[model samples]
Target chain A: MLTPLLLHVSILGLAAASALGLFATRRESPSMLGSARILAIVATLLVLALQLRRGMEFGGLPLVSRFDTLLMVAVLIVGAALSIDLTRGLSVLMIGALPVALAPLLFAAAIGMPDEHPERNLMHPAVGVHVFLTLGAYAVFGVAFVASILYLIEHRQLKARTGPSLLGMMPSLETSYRLTLRALAAGLVLLTAGIVLGYLYGRQVLSGASWRLDAKVWLTTVSWIFYVIVFGMSFVPAFKGRRTALASVACFVIVMATSWVASFWSHFHRYP
Target chain B: MELSVVGVNHRGAPVEVREQLSFEEARLPEALAELRRATGAAEAVILSTCNRVELYTVRAEGAAGAMESSHWLALQRGVPDSAIASVLYRHAGLDVIRHLFRVAGGLDAMVLGETQIIAQVKEAYRVAKDSGHADRVFNVLFQRALRVAKQIHTTTAIGAGGASVPAVAARLAGKVFQNLAQKRVMIVGAGETGEFTLAAFHERGTLDPLVVNRTVEHAERLIARFGGRAVGLDRLAGTLPEADVVITCLGSSEFCVTPDMVETAVRARRGEPIVFIDIAVPRNVHPGVNRIENIYLFDIDDLQGIVAQNISEREHELARCEPLIDSEARRALQELGEADVHEVVGRLRDAQHAMADEELRKTWPKLGALSPDQRQEIEYLLKRVTNKILHGPTTAIKEAARDGSTPVNFLEIVTKLFRIK
Candidate 1:
């Protein structure tokens, strides 16, 4: 069993990993990036194992609180994405996305534990499914956001007739753009399906609370509409370069904004 | 030992002159056989590439052997003895070995450190070996050359990256499309440069390409080979928008790809970036095309820029490789020197054993130990003593052999002091 001391060490390890990745990108060194990849992957595994152990102690999966579920999903996505990137020579993606993942975990630690114990709510399946799709979509967009940033950097360098400076370590502009498009397209589909499922579960499965719009729901819908336009424009044969990349990046930002609303709404709705 | 090479390469000779002097693959065997018939060389290997042809050989000891071989080679080539003599190069002993090693290492290639010539040299050796023409000396020499080439490849960074224009262009394409197999490439000419670039594109499994040339038949030939569609030059503008990469190497006097053409293509492309490489000296693509957004234009100057960088990198690696080559050459020379000692020692041991056996026969009967077995043991002891006595002198004889001058004093001392035939 990992003591509290070991868990603290794991957090430190995560910080070290983040620092290494950032340094590697700044230095434009593959050897440094390769080392950072190893450190990040190890920290992720240790953190996941600790989360799993803590999760089992509190009670089984469904009985655990929604925040725990959110935390678990975030850990799983970061772990899986980093592992995949390591194998595919996409280590630089972690440099762009992992800091965002680290932010929530660090914030939760600072805020201390929940006052109310998690109850075994009957609407468990609906909540679990909704959170799963939403977080999964976030992870996919995380990848898309990284790719878009790379595209912009590469496009600028090419325009300026200068070399890639530090950004050359990222995948090529064409590669980045294509990957962004694929991830964004997939995320849009998942988001649409997830929104529909949430409405259905609220009406039929849970108590027949009349369907009402919340800040979180409205913002999510708005982001979904933005993505739909982005996806629609991709089919136009002429608009296949920097414009497509910028559109995907814009959609990811909206997606990130929706998450902030969800977090804010979850805090108010639960605490109130 | 002296070594000299007299030959004109791509730098020194015109294409027409090189073409006239170059030996075709079909005629190489006949040439080799005639060379052997004329020169009376026990062993020879001919290294013939597009850029240069060289003959390497080992001559037996004596001035007569060198003169006869040189005369024979001049006659077989159907040139006058003086003309042939003037153009031909010769190297003897260690210098000859060093020359072969350098040639195999790609130091002698038109593009320094290019790998294609190594294979060409290997094939040349193979052809010679197959013709039952390579003797023990040539066999060892060629094998050493091949080994040295391989050593240079693994130990040095000389061959890293794509060295040629086509290869570099294709590599750039790979940076654009993560998987080139999914991309479409277009070739705008059927010239030699275009064909080379086509080969590079074809190597990437993801690219599907089309060929367009002024001559429809030539374009069709390229398209047929690569499974790409063919079109006449008239349809180049129609084809441009569909391609992700457009490479032009036409020999035309006028611009085949103009600013207006690129402007229309980019608009039609819907802001998709199209990579263009114009690798012709006369400039087949217009300079104004580069101003169009999302149209990346790289002309001959850009490729030359890369080549210059690559050459300098190779030169850096070449500095690292030179010491290795020198060490190997020095080691080979040392081995050859040691072999001379071994030969002399072997002869001395044989002479001593024979003399001991003769003396034993005469003295055995006189020694009254009686039994043949007992007598045989004494003879063996005598032979061992003779061998022990001869060992030091035999070693000295070998040391003398390496100086390459008169060892008459050393030979006289050994004969007079030992008093043996």
Candidate 2:
């Protein structure tokens, strides 16, 4: 009851925060949005607390059910946004971040939590690391995507000499670039960790399963390669603006598409 | 006290003449003491810079006090009265207040929006203030002037962005590429304008520029002054693709960078964005090259356009600050009208203005679809109505404040309505 109730409250809190973020953006008051951001973070923590309580009751990780895994990932995304934004004083990012944080929770609430499998050790600790790492990467990329959209807006307004548009509510182009680098680094580290953990789990834990032939494995590998190229582009001056923005969005799309494929079709990710 | 000013600025005098009229920093106290004794003014301040020397005073004797001080100024500098009179200008009454406000706001600056004058004036005021040359009236006046200056800057774009041509170009370059240290800049000339532009980029940490000039020796000379590889003009096509930014500043009449050359570079870059800044007078790059995708081309005229736009945008920002200045100035004058007015009306007026600003912002977007003229008209109407409603009550408050006898209920009513903190 507490878990579902907290999730519902978080969904409402995040939605309100998003709305307040819109208002604060136009007003150019970072402080107003800062409060709403704090509220959203508090709501996120409540959802996290609920997950822990559920984990205690069920005698396993908070990520037992599919809904719980989705929600857990959503928490990380919110956590990433909160930490980066609070540190940089980019409270305006909450305009994009709150909605992104809300999406997974809303979806999870809609679908209901998946039943836990009896022999749950197949959902191994290595698998948990992979899942958490992948989600951390996804959340970081999500922020970069929002930053790109803001970058385009700022670039346009500056080119045209319009004084203060919605982009004024966002950070400067230089700031967006800094945030993009942070996201890129986080994505690279987490994705690399996920790949390392996936390999070890496949070799030692699930030997002779023919997991190498799996569509999910190939798709994830392809996505990983794509991110690596995107990572290289961040260093190259030629790959800024819409190109980098598009690359980040495209890589994230692959992440989601393959996540769906693995959940339904592949034996590696899903459990009863 | 009646306020008056006597000064010679860049407009009224040549720099040589202004320098002659100027006061040395060490002798400021002696000059202030001498001026006060000569003019019989209650208080005085002397602001002396390369561009201007202004003597400000408040006295019981009014206009004669200003002349007496000006005469003293002339005698001290060993200049005859006629020589001083050649450049001297005087302001009395409200004009003195307006002049000081304009000086603090940077409107009186030789370069519009230059901020150094405010600091200079503040320094002058501080000296006058600490040494007992300036007392209550001068203190309130200068303090209010500084407040008005800060208010103007906070509310306007006038002092917001870089105002110079090279600074604008550097800012533009900064916008295109975030890490100036990483990106390669190519400066394709070895002249004054080229050196300045290159230095601006260098200042931004775009350290290694590939210099390409018609004469490789000149390019090498520039490379010695500013760190960069000297690429020969003959091999420009090969080197062009390596640079994220290409600045063409040849003094020659003909086009230095052609459409074909940019096309070759673009193809090499796989349509990567390249910023082309043509600072040359006769145009170094063909205007047709702007047709290329991912190419940003800015000439001197284009940069000047940005400068003009920024100035105009800053002016728009100034438009917002003007009314606030007027209100705050009037409030200052009101307190001057009666010393008790500050103790009574200060907090209440601040609260009311805050409420006005908050409400205006909340309602601004609702009127967004209307034309600017229509919106401005509506704003005027709103301001007129609010001012009209407040005028009588404010007058009564000031009247009540003449001897610290403001009705307690009047304060309570306003505080309750506005929820004044």
Candidate 3:
């Protein structure tokens, strides 16, 4: 009962924060942005508390349920947004990040908390680390996705000479570009480590099973390769500002699709 | 005391008239002393800038005081009364408060929302205070005005964007580069526009710029004024890769920076971002270069468009600031008025205490010699009665003063009733 209540409260709080963030973006009010940040912090804490309760109920970390994974992703997204340096531009970034963070929680609310625990092997330490690293990468990429969107908006505004309007509240093109590149790099590194760990664990434990044929493995590999190409294209002269932003956005979409497909179709990696 | 301002600004007079009446910074102390002496102003501050010359004074005579200060100003500056009279404007009482707030808030600036006026006002007040010309009223007024200006700028987008072409160029470059000081600047021409643009970047801490001009001598002259190395146009291609920002103002028919040149530079820089600001007629940098990755190009038209937009944004913010300033000005005036009310209240309380002591002295002779405890009880009773008697009037006076509902001469009535001299 307490876990469900916490989840609802966290969802409502994040939704309110996102609404306030959007209002702040339009009005350019520093106080309003500050309030939104505070609200997001509180909501993030509630989500974390809910996860802790579920972990206690399951006798270990709650990494098996779809609801748990989504909650973890939300926490990571909000955590990254909160932990970043609070510049004037960070307010605008939060305007994007809060909604992205809220989405996973809303999805988790729809799925509801699980009544049953997963197979024992799913709670293995290796699996737990792999899930955490992969989710951390997802959250980082999510930030990069928002940064890319802002970059595209700011880039277009500058190109069109629209002046400092609502879109002008966003960070500069250079800032947005740098943020996208850095977040992507960080996400790629985590994703690589998670994939390596997962590969090794599968080799050691599922030696007799055809784990290579799993749909999750294929989708995750494809997403990783796409991100690698996107990161590489950031260096090429032809794909710097607009093109790189576009590619990063597309890469995140692929990432989301991979996660969606993996959850429903993966033979062994499915969330119970 | 009443507050007053008498002045000529860009709106009221031309530069010739303003400069004639302007006071030099070095002569401010002498000028302030003389003005106070001549006009009998209790407090005075003179704010002189390129766009305006204002004399802020506190005196009992109100408008007459402002008028006398203006006359004194004209006579001191050797200007004919008739010549200065038509251009002179005056504000007294609460209007003086509003006007000063507007001035300090940059609403009265030549460029709307410009920030320099606040600094100038601060200096003017600093001079007055340091020279013993500013007293209680002027100190409170000027300090409140400065805080109001800061509040306006912080809460509203009044000073949002740059207003000039060079400023906009620097702003654009700032958007591209995180730290401009570390970036190398290359000026493509020796024209005045290029010099201004280079100076804008120089102010942003880009000290050494590589000057590429048709004449090495012309480039050297610019480099001499602003620290940098000079090179002829032939070195443009050789030096192109080294600069992080390139400002072009050469009046050439063809593009001085072509796409090929920029493409090669991009390759050499390893995908680092570069900004190109083209501020020349016929355009110096090639338009095609903007298409190249890592190249951000903005021409004169773009800068002007952004400037116009910024100006419009400031104007929109002015509407929002009007109500805020109006309320703040009114609140400040009431608060300052309350200070007078507080003094009157204190005098009233003191008068009651004195009257109570006098009554006790008169009654002591009529009564027989009493014990110390009995006298002490009587004294305590009298003190409580005095407080009870004053509480009703005190609350009424404070409430009336707070809400601006106090009757005219209400304090005067209280003072006369109590004989609180």
Best by DockQ: 3
Model 3 chain B: ten consecutive residues of lowest lDDT = B58-67
lDDT (C-alpha) at residue B340 in model 2: 37
Per-residue lDDT tens digits for candidate 1, residues B281-311, read 7998888777776776777666656666767
Worst 10 residues of 2 chain B by lDDT: B403-412
lDDT of each: 0.68, 0.75, 0.87
DockQ in order? 0.23, 0.07, 0.46
lDDT of 1 at B21: 54
lDDT (tens digit, per residue) of candidate 2 on A1-272: 66678888888888888888887776555566776887788888888887888777667666656787778867887887787777877676657778877888888899876554435664466676776787777788778767766666665655554432322445656667667767877787887888788878778867686887777777777777888888778667557555676677677777777776677776665544
- Real contacts retained, model 3: 0.41
Please name the candidate that would achieve the greatest lDDT relative to the true structure: 3
TM-scores, in order shown?
Answer: 0.66, 0.69, 0.91
Against the true structure, candidate 1 reaches a TM-score of 0.66
**Per-residue lDDT tens digits of candidate 1, residues A4-85?**
4444565677677789888877655566777877776676766666666655665544214444544554465466458558
Q: Which ten residues in a row have the lowest lDDT in candidate 3 chain A?
A: A159-168
Error of 2 at B12 (Å): 8.5
